[model samples]
Target chain A: MNHALDTRHAALLLAPLTLLMLLFFLMPALSIVWTSVHGGQLDLAAYRELLTSALFRRVLATTFEISIEATALTLVIGYAIAMHLARLTPSARAVMMIFVMLPFWTSILVKSFAFTIVLGDAGLVNRAISWLFGTETPIPMLFNRVGVVLGMLNFLLPFMVLPVLGNLLAQDRTLQRAAETMGAGPVRIFLRITLPLSLPGVLSGVLMCLSLSVGSYITPALLGGRTDMMMANLVDFYTRQTLDWPAASAIAMVLLLITALIVVLLTRVRGGNVEVL
Target chain B: MHNSLPDRMTRFWRATGGLIAWSGYLFLLMPTLILVPVSLGGSQQLSFPPEQLSLALYEQFFTDPSWWGAALQSAKIATLSTMLTMLIAVPAAYALVRGDFPGRRFLNLFTLSPILVPVVVLGLGFYLNFNLFGIGGSDLSLVIAHTILIAPFVVVSVSAGLRQIDPALETVATIMGAGRATIFFRVVLPQIRDSLVVGALLAFLISFDEVVASYFVSGPSTMTLPVKMYSALRWEISPVIAAVSAMLTILSLVFSVALIHLQKKSRGH
Candidate 1:
């Protein structure tokens, strides 16, 4: 259908949002680039520091390392849950979806705090372990990589599960039935028909999880140690503790670039896969 | 269906898969749910399965000025931002969905651009922008930043609502001599009220829960609950936060269920 409003009225309606985005969103974003280049004097000193600084390099490495690990773990666990959800009846799936979506409703800070409560030295897990095994030493979980990954897995699992489940549910059941009628075993049918069809969903889920993991701040800040800091934590450290705006903006620029690159690549890969799913 | 080797293996796989899947669900629900009992504990120290079950922490949250003060401030800011976001996003959603204009695609993409940017970057950008304007660390700055952060969701939600409505209604209104503004206020708004409410609730929740940008923009004078919780959590795990967390969990649970209901209503329409 054709648009209801003509250009003049449409422009009038759209003006507020356009102006808001430009003034608040676009200009502030540009200010980051300007600040990164020595307050618009066109110097690359901040970028140079980002490239050469050992601390920055290690933080970058840690960011990628933790994100990749978290993404892998989320995909594995998320896929299992999604697969199970797909097999259930629709009414059952609707009930199970609430459990899947519970984390999304809770604030990240609360969830992170909950993790600390559960995983701390005197927390429930250690208490359970010590009680059962008759041991005094608690397994160190909090303020480490384990805590960060666990928190991230909780936050990111829904992102992975929803997309994969969408694809799994969208798959043709007749193909599986036809394969079964041809004497193909359940395992073979799953491997050939279901798994291959679900690849797009898995890919989309992976990209979403990986992107979220890479830029995540709250989890790492609350649950991680100094060495376990992600790029976002580094951004916070530079912005707040060190009072280094240039260094912070430079780091921000790098993060923005990486995220944009991933999104661009994902869209390219996802273009053809849309119809398949 | 009988116990052939493949059928038995399939059953075993289903059983184990269900176990693992349920374990994953437990992991998702456990952390947040565990906070309730922790909040009920009567001690300074944080422990699960509370040593003494009491309403001590809950009482403290209500009585404490700093915690309650921050909560009120967050509510104020979230409300303002939600209003501001809807003020802009509703019209934009209408235009994007029903109005023909130049740069329509560009406008759609521009609205969503904020979500693509890492929030930390947006936080820093706002920090710098507000500092440049000499308005850094103000409630107004935080409100503006939050509106920017959450506008896209409102726009998307309202746009979906707009799409589902019949265009013929507007066309009929126009044919019967109603103006665009009249139709929008009289005809369109009522039709999309459920979505608008859902979107507003979502905007409220997001702005209230926002931490990264608020951290940079809010000052000691205007510290939000999440920002306060964040700083406190960074240093030490405060027992009071468990009460705060429990309350927040309940609040979000209520809003989320309401949102689900409103969504179903919107879709059902």
Candidate 2:
């Protein structure tokens, strides 16, 4: 009857969610590891093949390459925008944040589809090009590495901006004033003080973007050429196309490990705050 | 006032920075905004400015069984999944917030681990596990998968809500001879109603937008709207798909505006 229950009552209260997670969430996730190892009685053949196969290795490399590219692109653009947003008055910021957050709230499918239209042959960019320069042929943008990165940036920018913006907003205003009083120019103060203070945010944003971009299946599959397949697509390839559960599970495990490694490294590098999530 | 070279250089840099940042904002917004006009295309081919504006795509979306049917199926699944996620998440949120127990930190991490795991991996895992149970493509399987996908968000939102309320409220209820159920329903629930609604909205939106996991677990009959759009995109480019995208974007916009309003209201309380 008391509000604060003993451990027994606490456990009872937690039982339903605990059971739900254990049965559906934990069991399904654990099955990936099981299938990865026990391909009919304790086999590591999938992992061995993954190590030996050029195609899998190439895909893994591409995943990291694309993720890094996307993360770098997102950070540059996101930092610029976050810098601008941080300087805005609160009322103006609220309005601007709607724009930043709207795309994030929308489905990734819708965003991808929009990118196809905006970057496709008869899309907006091509139309603008024709109108501007009288070009007859539209430049290809939608099915290459360019398109993949562009599509990814649309979804990833908000993740980067929000975090960096948080850190920027949290900075002491008097620090900048102090630096200015010391005859530091705006650029010098920003470079010496603001940039260093905001590195944790930039690091976390990089982490978020990289992890999301690495495990992304939709953007590359929709926008990239066949040569641009990432690890997630490889997982999908084995699962849907080839029906090789072990191979799929192996790639998934690798992805899981990469993501875990990123989290661990970033958190540690950021002085063990663990707030990257 | 001094017209100094350094001041002029600073102004120039500020202008350049604003231009770069505004361009980034434009890039962020362009894709979403482009869908609205394209969705109004009069022709069958997808294009910008649409050549001629019409509601034919919207008409198609409504009259066609595939589009509207998938919409209905998504709504149903999201509703059910939201309910299931809330049911499991609310009490666990209460336990995490109020009921002190060992391994609470572990429990918190476990609850949120699903969000950290890759969806593609979760999809395959769900496919394998559900196939083992012989319910791989059923609506039930999709619902369960979705609940797992969204339960973490519900837990986080509800737990935040629970944290906001004073513990003394519960003590007062207990002192007045109210049981746990009465204290929760009467004392705690009323205070956190706004956040409960927020959690439900978030769960519904997340479940509604989910595609990767549903793509694996759902059969042809059980395909949700996003999954249908995904397949449709892979196979062809139709104006109606544009309409679908526009509608979904609007849905997201509406939900987000509502969420922002609710969050402000909750925080005010």
Regions of candidate 1 where Cα sits further than 4 Å from its true position: A1-3, A130-136, A269-277, B1-3
Q: Give the C-alpha miss distance for residue A125 in model 2, angstroms.
A: 1.5
DockQ of each: 0.63, 0.64
Candidate 2 structure lDDT: 0.87
For each candidate, what is the lDDT? 0.87, 0.87
Model 2 DockQ, alpha carbons vs. true complex:
0.64
* lDDT, candidate 2, A1-277, per-residue tens: 4456668767887899899788887888789999998654678999999999999989988898889999999998999899999999987998888888877788988998888888988888898999999999999998899999998998899989988999999999899889867677768887999899999889889988887889999999999998899999999999999988899998999999988888677657666434322
DockQ of 1: 0.63
Worst 10 residues of 2 chain A by lDDT: A268-277
Q: Which stretches of model 2 miss by more than 4 angstroms? A: A1-4, A133-137, A266-277, B1-3
Compose the digit string of candidate 1's lDDT tens values, residues A1-277.
3437888888888899889888888888999999899889999999998888999999999999999999999988998899999999986887788788778878999999999889989888898899999999999999999999999999999988988999999998999888867777767877899889999888888887777788999999888988998898898899889999889999999999998887776667577221111
Lowest lDDT 10-residue stretch of candidate 2 chain B: B1-10
State the iRMSD of every prediction, in order shown.
2.7, 2.2
User: Could you estimate the TM-score for every candidate?
Assistant: 0.96, 0.96
